[model samples]
Target chain A: MEEWTVKVEQSDNKKEKPDTEQLEFGRSFTDHMFVMDYSEPVGWHDARIVPYQPLTIEPSAMAFHYGQSVFEGMKAYHAQNGDIQLFRPDKNLARLNHSNDRLCIPPIDEEFVLKAIKQLVYMDKEWIPKAEGTSLYIRPFIISTEPYLGVAPSHHYKLIVILSPVGAYYKEGINPVKIAVENHYVRAVKGGTGEAKTGGNYASSLKAQEVVGKQGYSQVLWLDGVEKKYIEEVGSMNVFFKINGEVVTPALNGSILSGITRDSVIEMLKYWDIPVSERRISMEELYQAYLDGQLEEAFGTGTAAVISPIGELAWEGKKIHVNEGEIGNVAKRLYDTMSGIQYGKVEDPFGWIVKVKEAAPVK
Target chain B: MEEWTVKVEQSDNKKEKPDTEQLEFGRSFTDHMFVMDYSEPVGWHDARIVPYQPLTIEPSAMAFHYGQSVFEGMKAYHAQNGDIQLFRPDKNLARLNHSNDRLCIPPIDEEFVLKAIKQLVYMDKEWIPKAEGTSLYIRPFIISTEPYLGVAPSHHYKLIVILSPVGAYYKEGINPVKIAVENHYVRAVKGGTGEAKTGGNYASSLKAQEVVGKQGYSQVLWLDGVEKKYIEEVGSMNVFFKINGEVVTPALNGSILSGITRDSVIEMLKYWDIPVSERRISMEELYQAYLDGQLEEAFGTGTAAVISPIGELAWEGKKIHVNEGEIGNVAKRLYDTMSGIQYGKVEDPFGWIVKVKEAAPVK
Candidate 1:
């Protein structure tokens, strides 16, 4: 494995850290960040951890003009004993490479990149807030840096990792939110880049999101692009529903992101011997289930929120309240168990958590 | 209209202009450029023409991570009488607003932006190459400048216009080329950003482009995203077919970009009293037409090449030669007439040409 050079910031900015109680998602940054570059034939080189600063990229870089970029989001939890732990970061790096494959970007050594992420997190370990539900959000992304304006994959790329101290996703703590079922705008189709965590998918979703937000909904529930019948995903999260004691989610049908948290929820349910399934569930069936009082719960899972319970779903001018517009037992259990393992409070039988080692102070 | 501030470069770089014969598209830039800013409430402000320089954007800018960017392509022509002109630049600005609407970006005043474009183009008129079939390509793009990583429309944006003196799109003049019909990857779908001239749509096409490029094809003919059966577009251009005696191009479905060049071709065909139809045409129907010897010509139209004749098509291992692997009479006439009007060699009776006036030196 190649070693990553560490250049600690000469003027540390940790003293300007915001009060953890009022932190928002992805707003503030840590003192240091990790960066690497890749060029043709040279492979990925210049791996280093440097001070957090604005990047000087060419105006005509492919990333700005062609949208040739992908990013991964994960978090580092601060345990009660001051240990920093990451939940399933290996899966995130693996998914990043998977996204790169679909986007025609060069793949990085997953193990080596993960090590670099850990080192960067360790260097800025003090930024990990000790408050409950607070963690250091890590965003790792690759952007095309080639200073040309053509509709092709860039010849040069830069991989950057930045750390942000984020507070709890729900200010009031895990309250159920309403969502609007989007019928006009489509997110991804079978042959599209939906399965890949690329920027285009999210960029295409802003219109629907804005419309739904204006209607007082917290998120938009995206349907399959082809028929617009089958459920695809919710916002940027993988969705799940508890119908008649069975937990189900839309299958990874090449149009939904293979979320790590979604996978963990399935695993946790299966471990507890609860009935679980991965298959296509249409909105009609879900509404019917709700009408019959069999729709127990509906929620979204992602790294940022961990669990976002869906209270009411507005579909075609009709509303279906899930679990009495309140958090369901299944969602609460999953969120607690998942976050428990992440915070080192619960026993991790799946070998998911990777602890970070503290780094020595720089000269 | 408000007059834009002009900030000419103190150090002239006219001596560094590349030889027009060896010029590559979008590689070398001109001496000056145009810029404008958009923010909440203030709308678009600070319109100015400034020297071409690298932009200093934050690494966490929403444009870099979420692909909140849109761009337009047009060209400035040097007339035989030393007059500089633009061909239907109003149409480009109109299309730019259309794209901005789809991406949830704030729209600019079309007439005002057009004035800015003309002022900037006239200031750098020396960069308009005098070589045959050569013109100065103008790229006006808007990028989100908000320093955040959320998946939402940005409140702050910057519109930048850069000029590049480009040679003929085809190195050896316009010639018919071979294309492969892509069956796997999709470009865009109904209710997607395909209709917008945005970066994401172009970014998603690079993978398929790379694959076909390896198969010795110049471009990949894109199929509809949902069914992957009906023809959508070829590369970045709108496609056309001359069957028997009539000209036909795909109708502007939601998933197809309404290309300015494509519209011009249709207008020209109608002006010449040629039978033209804008409707959906499937590849199967095209193949059937080829089998019956009714497919007389095939070509693609866009700003970059204006007209790209398709001499050969390889689909599912079957190769069909278009017009005996030669440019058809219609394709030749269209290319000649288009270039003729652009170069001021033909009378533009359609009132499509807009002349540019010389700009005074900056104070």
Candidate 2:
């Protein structure tokens, strides 16, 4: 691990913190943000914390035209006793590098960048909402900044980390969401950018989301791009199904995103002696299981919601109800345990929590 | 068509023009650019031609995070008698709207935007290169500019058009280049954003291009994402093959871009009474044609290259040479005729040329 010196510049005019109860996802930002530049020779340099403001970019910047960009999503929780904590931050940074490789962007020093993120979060500690189900969402993204219009990898890049205080994903407790099984559109396929947390994958998914959203579905459950039969994901989250007393998830084919919360849930299930399997689970098999009354529960896992319960699935004009349109016991327990460990209320047996220290006093 | 007002603001400090012969593709931009803003209720508004400069965008803009952006590439040629002409600019604008629909961006009025482009090009008439094969490259792009970070369609957007003086794609005569058939990576699937000229498709292609480039190939021929057997595109251009005196190209499947130059080539072939077909083309079928000595020629068509002849193809540990690694007769004739019509040296039979008049005297 390299010890990189990150320069700090406090903002002269700090923003008034937003009301925690009214906080929206990615709407309000903190006063300061961590910034870094990357170019050839000087791989990644000029690390500094400056005021969160608009970026002056050329209209021909490669990210705007070529979509050579990558991002990560995580959060900072205002834990008990005034401590600030991060859940599986290292995993998120590791996934960021994986996404960079897929997008052909240069890699970052994850450990050093994690330190900078902690510092930025600490600098804006007041922005971390302490209300229940509220925390500061951390978005670390990299964009190709070169002004040339050529269709090639950019030499210049910008890595930025911004903090946004967000309210709970579910305002009225952990409720289930209706998901439409996508048939006409695809999110990603094997050998595509689906496994990476890049902008294009999300961009490609908007149409399907919009279409299903208009049909009164809260989100969409994406099937495999090839067969369009096997389950892949549900609204940018890794999906799991409890069938016949066993939990099964769509194995990470090349196109499925490797989710951190998905990893945590599997580990937690293993620790609790719950039967879990990651394999190719086809829609036909799931439907057969439903017909046999073996379908027990369904849920999605991600950093935002931690665990999202799927109540109903509409596939090819047929609706399939899961767990009688209620949150399953496993989902409720997983969410409680995950949120408990995240907010420092439960024992972190896996050592996934990283703490941010308060600023040291000047000598 | 509704007539709209376009405001103009000339730059106080105009940049010195670069040497025509020393120009590179998309490196040197013109002095001015056209821009328009789109928002809900207001729709597409504030069309203006302003000085070419950097854009001040929020760090959290949706374009940077989700890659909801689309762009079109065409050119303005400096004709033989100092007239500036555009080749099938209407096709490019129509395709731009198609891309907008796929990316969930607001659509632009093609007629209004084309008029704005002509006005901007007329304003920067001196920047159009006069060298033999050089011209002004026009890039019209739309980006989601909302500062919010939700994974949905953006309500705010920016439509911008910039001009860059580009040299000839081939410094010497139009020569053939080696291409590698990409096997491991996929560009797009049938239900994906492949047909749309969005950033994600290009971003997904960089890795395959980089891998093949290291193997001494200039470009990679993309296969269908689902089966990886059918040919989709070559580099960023639409590919065509002449087999047994008939030209065949991949049909407009949902996963292949609909190129304007490609359309021109098909129409020109039809006009010449040469056999041409747009259908699903498999690499195996092409290989069989080569084996039977029936493969006549292969070429790619796009705005940048106009016509790129394929000399050799390396696929699955086998190398197949086309036309003895030389430029084919049809490719040469197409390039000559296309460039001739674009530069105003030949007859325009298909009504493809749209001339930009000289700016009227300000009275």
Candidate 3:
């Protein structure tokens, strides 16, 4: 006898035409989802495809009391071959486990989650829109659901994979964005959860987002917590700037999230033979260089927005316009090349694509 | 017509009394609990006393995905008048709302939660063991249950209050505990969720706890993230040290949590005519003072353990014994007075007690 059993959920058989135009990024999810449970007695069990519904758990589950949770976001692009494909999901799975170890949540079999994602994507593949820059965004998460609220590791956890149909990241179509250079309020600090793909880092960014949004900025350009001088990632994305025709970004400082899109840009830039450097780039350096006409382009990279070319940076009530308020040559090339590989328009030399099978409507 | 509705669950006839000595800290819950739900159509509704049972939620709830949750802990003590009383619940309510504003969860009416907690305590009054240094612990938590894996705030949330009979915090009773002075890893940081009673800060401390737990310490004596020089807080408590016979604590830096018990100690000490001060005390200064025999005693204060003294501090292969490895005079006086007030053995001068009416046992 097995330790756990899958109680498969019967779908409601409600298939409406998905309206791609009126969609906010993460508000609309696909119909079906995948789930698995982890226990001390049983590592991972009850893997199943289920109709998307609310779950039943104890009120004192560790997730609510202790925040023993981790998550990852990746997009399933509607390829030219009429199939949705995931971009390097294994990287996400590996990072998820890394965060799990940090929170002391049980480790997940990386390959199993990949297999489950494949199944769920096939089940709700219609949710994948075909318009340019549109894709089915996938969210994979693990949470400790143990009932006890002790200040220690939980014994039980749940892992779930959900899909959402999303429109173009730059919904108004690739226009340059303004960012606020935040001197205070570090999103993640050294020796903290900065490197983990956990909820706290995102939660830490909400206040900064509200502040920057009120100032008409797209996001907050985080600075190092120690000195508040060195450049870091934006609220939810990695930042890059074009200096002297060379691509430069803040190196992996153990205090910034390792973005998948950040890695992709570096790879494509190297493939194009463009000079790329990752080092401790400072805010003063970028601002001063922009004043001296050395800073050509600046953009942010993340799962939501592939590459958002920054138009202006608001600092201490002064706006620093980049490239005369226009998208530079480097931002466009990086965005187009990365999106091409993701959408199957260009050859995937790194073989990042994971083919999603066809959708099967419920009976 | 009301802000919240009640779910009145009467206690069962069969109530088994557990051995008070064997009761674990947070594992045993009482018979009844209070809960309220939040939705867009209805702001906050369905508040009531419900049977202590497992809760049902969506696996993709915002609390699980983005850590959009907050919790408060307090104890209900049974007094000599056969009446149950609660400590400064108003403070918990205000702090909860402050946390709610940051997480974007709607704040339920404070009166409703107060009444709900009263009803829960009345129903499960028997679970309040008469043993010394023990009481019925109440955990009030709010979690965003929106059934989607988005990083943004949740539209749906649930506020829940549960009662659990907890044993003595210290096994041998009031004995000083050993701690590790952490030079790395931060509990809270500037402009982060440290000041808010958020789960993210607790989650960030999980790995630190694990690493320090291996080094033969109960908790980490955390330092400031930016500098790792100033003392911040202990695992789940606020630190107070006696320097040259003066009670000193870390100031309300934007980093340390505003603990209710920490406030109570400050007020009580001031009332007792003790030289109380809330200032930024550094670890280096603390160690130097300890060496000079000016550091009389150090104690941690919180809702769980009213006051626990510290015997030793280990850091970077240096082990420093505090107050000659014993509970010092200052720690004893504060712990005795606070515990006396909490247990209703002393005069209630500050009007901190909110008495509860006990329910008759089921026939």
Best by DockQ: 2
**What is the TM-score of chain A, computed separately for every candidate?**
0.96, 0.97, 0.94
Better of 2 and 3 by DockQ: 2
lDDT of 1 by residue, A1-363 (tens): 134454444435544888988898878888888888999878788787878888887667888788888899999999877789999999999999998988899999897788889888888888999988999999999999998877788889999999999988776777899999999999888877899988888888999999989989999999998889999999999999999999999999998999999999999999999999999999999999988999999999999899999999999999999999889999999999999999989999999999999655321
- Global Cα RMSD, each model: 2.1, 1.8, 3.3
Kindly list the per-residue Cα lDDT of model 2 for residues A5-35, writing each as its tens digit.
Answer: 7888889998999988788999889999999
User: In candidate 1 chain B, where is summed lDDT lowest over 10 consecutive residues?
Assistant: B1-10
The residue ranges of model 1 lying beyond 4 angstroms of the native Cα positions read A1-15, A359-363, B1-15, B359-363
Q: lDDT of each structure?
A: 0.88, 0.92, 0.82
lDDT of 3 by residue, A232-262 (tens): 8976889999998899999998788888899
Best by TM-score: 2
* Between candidates 1 and 2, the lDDT winner: 2
The all-Cα superposition gives candidate 3 an RMSD in Å to the true structure of: 3.3
